[model samples]
Target: MEQSLYPVEFLHFGIHLKFELTETGIFLKICVVNFSVLGLFFHRPLALNLKAQPGENVTLSCQAPDGVDIEWSRTDLEELQYVFLYRDGHIDSDYQHQSFKNRVELKDKEMKNGNLSVILKNVKEEDSGTYECRFKAAGEGRRKRAFIKTKPISTIQLEVADPDPGELSGCRLNLNSLTGFYFMLEADPEQTLCVD
Candidate 1:
């Protein structure tokens, strides 16, 4: 009796795959060689960069090998804002910022695809703080911080209250009332009097 068989093999970067065929069935084997170069060629997802203006819009993005879930929050706060969670190819609406209620929104709602930018309108000074973007995958996640800068309101001297005659000593002072009170200026150096 004569028997016939076929053998197959595949090789790539120290990874070897072999298949053996016999009369009854086929057997397969896969062998991986421990090599340092293989690790360098693999691609891995990294944290994304997020930033925004005090009263403007911003986005926090992340890229991962698989689907991702994002959560945004501040370091000082104990709770986290779920933001727009992208999972199962849809965004969950249960989580949203009350402060941003209707004024803010996320672009490319599919957070799993790496577009997690947030839009905010009429940003306030209190909103100028560090915001964190966290990405979750397979129960593991990473965090990145975003900074917001707000413009400070210009300070104007509203009024210079009238001081007692004893308070006016050696220096000459000018006063302006923000309430539109027109004070009379007297040149008398004897006593400081309030005139309006």
Candidate 2:
């Protein structure tokens, strides 16, 4: 299935993802030079705004290619912000912040298919801040062994609010990541309202 070069995927986060169909396998080649396209064309804020009530569980989403080391933390909590760290195929608890000692965990411990999202349990008002996920990408081209620390690959502004009387029970949040789209289906025993 050798196909001609063409733009076959959605343009996400200013990065142009070109997927080529070849006999060997479908290859994804990302052009970082076009990072400017995001601001130049969309004129939109990069951080995704999300809201959750205190005591509710929320997931801060992130995605990157496999083989990359990922770090999840609260950008606002500078004093003790290291939320979760995964490297060398295991969680590194040595550097994790005490506040997040037992409150945060990876959605998928295996991280299969590059799902780097973290589930923050028991949300608090103090946790209302910018949650960022960064990845250490392998150096491109000839310097494959070298590591490139990218700018905050994904930033999530989590607003912990207090639910009013008769407030809704569940909410669905959808956002695109550096490498793919992430969506969570909240518990809806009666009916699930699709987020369009």
Question: Largest TM-score belongs to which candidate?
Answer: 2
Best by lDDT: 2
* Model 2 / residue 2 / CA error / Å: 31
Q: Candidate 2, residue 53: CA error in Å?
A: 1.2
lDDT of 1: 0.40
Model 2 stretches with alpha carbons more than 4 Å out = 1-46, 79-81, 138-149, 166-196
Candidate 2 local lDDT, 24-128, one digit each (tens): 999886655442112111112136788998898998888665555778877665543488877666777875778788999999887888688899999989888
TM-score, each model?
A: 0.36, 0.56
Number of backbone collisions per candidate: 4, 0
lDDT of 1 by residue, 1-196 (tens): 2221211111234556687888879877655564322111122323333333344444433333334444554444434443334433444455444554565556555444445555445555545445554444322222322211111111111111233454433333456666455444444457555554
Backbone clashes in model 1, listed as residue pairs: 55-123, 58-118, 59-117, 59-118
